[model samples]
Target: MSEYRSLEDKLNYQFNDEQLLGLALTHRSFSNVNNERLEFLGDSILNYVISLAIFQRFDSASEGELSRMRSSLVRKETLAEIGRELDIGELIKFGIGERKSGGINRSSILADAVESIFGGILVDGGFLNASSVITRVFNKRLEKLSSDDFMKDPKSLLQEKLQDMGEPPPDYIIISTKGKSPHEVFEVACISRVLKKEARAEGASKRKAEQKAARIALTEMDRDR
Candidate 1:
């Protein structure tokens, strides 16, 4: 009960249906009836709620800008950060195998739990109630958000900068991969032949690693110039 109290306190919401909360906390590896479906539903709702909020808040922002901001806000890394704040990892229920494999700290699992919890809230109350919870969770982030966040992601920005400088597109190589699905560490190197620059970075996913590497390469190139 005390364990649940902490989660409820962080979310600032109580569940009328305790089963929904249980289901949300249950990972696929834990049970046959799990949170995957709820994750799917919650994913859609979260995207819509965030999109609407960004749309209303940034009246002067272009469509592309709004889209970019929404992407940043709804990304797995951002959601995982929010989940950690709520202590979702401590509350998650995993199978013995998953527990042994360190699923508790996996970013993908944490993010999925956040969304699954929202899906449960949506079912227990309604869209308005779920939206209210989302608003509470994302309030600080939205407040601190800047227009600069609306710019393209690191990878896209790097590509554009290189193209404008008449440099060839950067080539990404996977330096190494470690761990299993949903919790893997991917190290990637970004090399720009024309710029004679190379940078390496590691992330929880390959795409994220590539993005980080691109950011590093771009920073190095800027420094050289």
Candidate 2:
């Protein structure tokens, strides 16, 4: 009967306290009693679950490799991707201003909401249930992860490529930022002066924006080569 019944179905878990689910989907822009705390708790829970899963799945992986893979898996981009898959953006409760500014599709908001849902599940059901849900949701991603690709992020790879070509590293500059705290959107430009190339991108955070910009720059560089 709850409007969130569909989300519960996607998560494959029902909450005894429907309020918890509501809170998980509530953004700070919507209310003071939002999902930040839940996001923090869920971040930790997600890391643990993913770390354990990867550790077991890739038994031959070194510690450094495992760390890199975990970082890739737990990054905001990955979380945002998962959130999109679950259509979480549509369910998020945002403030009028945020909603008007397209907060629903914002990566940071989506990622935070996904984590908060995990936290809510932990609080409502227990670690077992929380882990079960996490594992189930991430099962395909875990299976599809490749050791060769997970070692380095886009930024790192771009930097290394530039270095190999005897070019200086790209500089990430914040072009502009919009919105208020916890819901801000940042536009960044990754400029490679030596290569005479530049790429611009927007994200919910500076680092994410820079990463995206770097990825674009990398793609352009590769295409030109």
Candidate 3:
């Protein structure tokens, strides 16, 4: 019924409840009409699934520890990775202007689509089916992120660094977010804790944006040493 038909075939999964898939493919910008509800359900479902996964995966983890891990899992950047894997980016529907700007590949959009897909599957198939599919999609990410390298995403790492320095911590300012909800322009800056200076970069999410800024700041800080 739509371009997403190709994507459905690609993911090696089909929905008897085709409407759910349709809802997932629809973008909020296309109209206020469809996607918002799915996104909402998807968001909650994702949180529940991820929390369960974290709780079981790390039994010794503290509440705060589990929370940080959950945040790492559910962030826009993480969901975008799942969306990209399904090639959902190419199949998404967008408004005309948003389409022209390449919104489909955006981290935020891809992330939202991941939620929509989760919500859709839950509606059509139930939590078990939705969770199975989502788990399949997230398995590799889960494994990789569990590694030491993912100890902190760029944002958290920067915050920790600032906190260690006894500073107020860096805050993000979005300079530009173009394209569509998915593949848009996202130029972000990190405001200094003390100097009030700012460093900036373009990335798909706030984490990425902040990472770039932090990298710059770290380099500058080292230089002064």
Candidate 4:
């Protein structure tokens, strides 16, 4: 035994199928092994678990309200935040190159690893058991999410701020689009109203590109203030 006690202590999941835990911790960059399938399953599992939590947590909330709340909980940022709380990044086994390149600190990578591990737990135990574990991990978060006023869309907020500043509304310009078919990268720039400062970002989708650009704008504005 390599003394896998650290993660078990962290997650409170004593794995009967310890290999599943190992598989979950293994990143694809490590080899031909794929965490993709587990990620897919885990994504669905997490949604269901979170959905139930939302439904029960908010009796007066409507379906749409619950959906929005659930969406907030399951976002990449939220998942990454939870992953950080678990210190899951420290436990992830990455390829030598990836480890050196700071892959463990990447939010997206950490989020995927957490989801894969959650799926592995589901496979090792029944759905109810898995749900129990997931719920426990997320209970505090669910309560916090329920209490907080949901954040407005960043892009929309950015636009509103620009308008209030008496500047022309923000505009997005597509600078470049590249990469293979399924993973095309989009680089976009957000043109600020008064400052004329252009901030750019790259993402896999147009919406993501827009959001990234907005985030850049927000950052630039804060520095000047």
What RMSD does each model have against the real structure? Answer: 14.1, 14.5, 14.7, 13.0
Clashes of each: 0, 0, 7, 0
- Candidate 4, 45-137: lDDT as tens digits: 999999888888788774444655776678788889888888888778899999999999999998897888889888988687778878888
Give the distance in Å from residue 158's predicted Cα in candidate 2 to where it truly belongs: 8.1
Q: Quick one: how many clashes does candidate 1 have? A: 0
Q: List the residue pairs that clash in candidate 4.
A: none
Candidate 4, poorest ten consecutive residues by summed lDDT: 145-154
Candidate 4 residue runs with Cα over 4 Å from true position: 151-225
**Quality of model 2 by C-alpha lDDT:** 0.88
lDDT of each: 0.86, 0.88, 0.74, 0.79
lDDT of 1 by residue, 63-120 (tens): 6567667766888889999999998897889999998999999999999999999999
Q: Cα miss at 100, model 2 (Å)?
A: 0.5
What C-alpha lDDT, on a 0 to 100 scale, does residue 81 get in candidate 1? 98
Task: Identify the runs in model 2 with alpha carbons over 4 angstroms from their true place.
Answer: 151-225
Model 2 clashes, total count? 0
Per-residue CA lDDT of model 3 for 5-56, tens digit only, reads 7666655567887877877878877877666788899998888887788788
